[model samples]
Target: MKDQITHLPDNADRSVAKQKFKITNWPTYNKALINRGSITFWLDDEAIQAWYESATPSSRGRPQRYSDLAITTVLVIKRVFRLTLRAAQGFIDSIFTLMNVPLRCPDYTSVSKRAKSVNVSFKTFTRGEIAHLVIDSTGLKVFGEGEWKVKKTRQRTPSYMAKVASGS
Candidate 1:
């Protein structure tokens, strides 16, 4: 008689393997990314000249609403890569800060709440498309802890997948 069951709280083996792929050549990676495209831009001469006449002197009120570019970058990446709230927050804090967006990055909870029910109706309604979605093939992982996966012999397997991880 024998009891054959292997149970552990976490996978220590995988963690070590993951650490091997550290970002050693981050500078090179940043240069390569710049070649692809960058969001930075100053107003062009012609564009600036044209808008000169249309500029208003000033609006008498409290200071205008301002959010850090980091937040916007995170939001944009979330839409582009279709990341979950937590992942989106992570993506921002990890790589997006390199862009120097000039604002304090919001915590994960702040990003989550804003993304779920932000004032997006205006933008959605103003878009040219009737359906409001140009290309909509995407998946979402809705769990905070991420996936539970282990390799049997190198093939990938999905234990579970969700669009919105519970416990928001």
Candidate 2:
């Protein structure tokens, strides 16, 4: 008396139900939604004051115009925004223009030149705790047996391979 099922897989009876997320807190949820699209940009006065390098006698070629801090700041911003050198220069100029700061933005060419010598150290967060890093040994040459030989011959994998695979 029942009709035969032509597409058995198309039926949802065998599939698990998808999860349903319901927001309980209206005020907190609304505030989080509003904050998601908001962006805040701020630079301290100390950094602004140190933007330009102090005039000093140079023994060799040409004296530096912008300070190392300025170069590092531009480079950091560029890296964070994934912007090109010229775009970074324009971004810095726009910020200064809007902020009414009298400082001049560094040129793209200058940034490119100074990048080679400037040592920019990026700060990494380990969730307020010391982070341990493990080095990968896969590319490293193992003294005993080669991976291809062991894999092809169906021999037991070495401990180093296991460690590399587990990333420990």
Candidate 3:
């Protein structure tokens, strides 16, 4: 029995493909780009009032100073900036100072404890609205070895040197 090789048909016109999507609303796109860097740290009066009013004490423990919303906000800020819990607390404190808001920011311990119970909600577009999403991804290979083991075990030999040393 003989094996047969199959070949795909090739196109002669090898031209670069043009982009399919075009920006229709430049102003909206520009505004979105601008707003991406603008982090709104100032809490509104309603939010402040809600936070203050949510300090009702439970029967077993002391009164809560921070609300779930406040803790969730701190967690969101931490995630957005990729900050540690301590760093997030400091960042929130700085923002509060900058905004001159007379509200107490949650400590790192409080934020960590409340984060597990905080309920977060994200806004969704209506059914009639259409959203275009473009996703791009790159693959990364990870080695599951400690740095010390990797350094100790790593053997470097050129391909020619390896071939010659093996007497091949």
The digit string of per-residue lDDT tens for model 1 on 27-140 reads 998996675443322222332223112434387744323232223434544664578767876765554356444424466665555455433211211111111111111211
Stretches > 4 Å off in candidate 1: 1-73, 121-168
Instruction: List lDDT for all candidates, in order.
Output: 0.39, 0.60, 0.52
Per-model RMSD to reference: 15.9, 15.6, 22.8
Q: Which stretches of candidate 2 lie over 4 Å from their true place?
A: 1-15, 24-30, 124-168
**lDDT score for residue 126 of model 3:** 20
Superposition TM-score, candidate 3 onto the true structure: 0.48
How close is every model to the real structure, measured as TM-score? 0.28, 0.58, 0.48
Model 3: per-residue Cα lDDT over 62-131, one tens digit each:
7778766567666655654569989988886887688787877688998888666665442322221111
Location of the lowest summed lDDT over 10 successive residues in candidate 3: 159-168
Q: Give the candidate order by descending lDDT.
A: 2, 3, 1
- Clash list (residue pairs), candidate 3: none
Query: Which candidate number has the best TM-score?
Result: 2
Q: Tens-digit lDDT track for model 2 on 107-163?
A: 999999988787665443222211111112111112222435556888754422211
> Model 2's lDDT to the true fold?
0.60
lDDT of 3: 0.52
